[model samples]
Target: MITQKAKYALRALTALADADADEPVMISDIAAQQKIPKKFLEQILLDLKHHGIVVSRRGKQGGYLLLKPAHTITFGEILRIVDGPIAPLPCLSITAYRRCDDCDGEQNCQIRHVFAKVADATRKVLFSTTIADAAQPTHSAEVTRLLA
Candidate 1:
């Protein structure tokens, strides 16, 4: 299950991606338009900034903007940024692998094999899909349907 924080990050990111390229957008504006709480969004944006997904400027005219183009930012990157490992099982994880306590030998484990397949398919879709794609009308519909 995707966490509420991850969902909020995606929403904030897509909102930033939808703005004019390289244009700074205020946190208040993003929070107001995206319906994310201001404090929560501030933290999310800060996390994104640390990940180099976004850059921020401070001052009267300062705000936030994407560090890279939306088309260059994959959903997988953002997901990992907020949620960590994408694997359904730690044994199947590439970044944070750990043996399952109940498992015997992973090599012949039926459950691990099955969940590995699930993780692979999910990873492919997420890693290949860009934020620009998520922000598109048709893609947004598909995402909503899938999440629903």
Candidate 2:
């Protein structure tokens, strides 16, 4: 399951994507527009900023913006930043791979095979799906509806 932090991070990133990429967006404005709690959004955005997923500006006109193009920033990357690994099981994670402690023989384990397939499919979709793809007008309704 996706955490609230990841969801908010994605929402805020989508808002940033919709805005002029060069122009920073006010945190308060993003929180209000995206219906995310300001305090929580602050922490999430800060995490993103630290991860180089987003950049922050300081001053009267300061705000946040994506450091990279939205299309280049995948949901997998964002989720990893906010939610840690993309795979449900550590053994199935490509970036955060770890052997299942319960399994002495993963090569022969049916459950491990199943989780590996699940992880692969999940990663394929997530890695292909970028913030820009999630921000598209065509998909915006579905995404927003899901979030709501």
Best by lDDT: 1
What does candidate 1's lDDT look like per residue over 13-57, in tens digits? 899988987679999999999899999999999999998999998
> Where does candidate 2 have its weakest 10-residue lDDT segment?
139-148
> What lDDT does candidate 2 reach at residue 130?
82
Model 1 misplaced stretches (Cα beyond 4 Å): 138-148
Which lDDT tens digits does candidate 2 get at residues 62-105? 99999999989988889988888888788887777888888888
Show pairs that collide, candidate 2. Answer: none
Give candidate 2 regions above 4 Å deviation. 138-148
Q: What is the TM-score of each candidate against the true structure?
A: 0.91, 0.89
Q: Score candidate 2 by lDDT.
A: 0.87
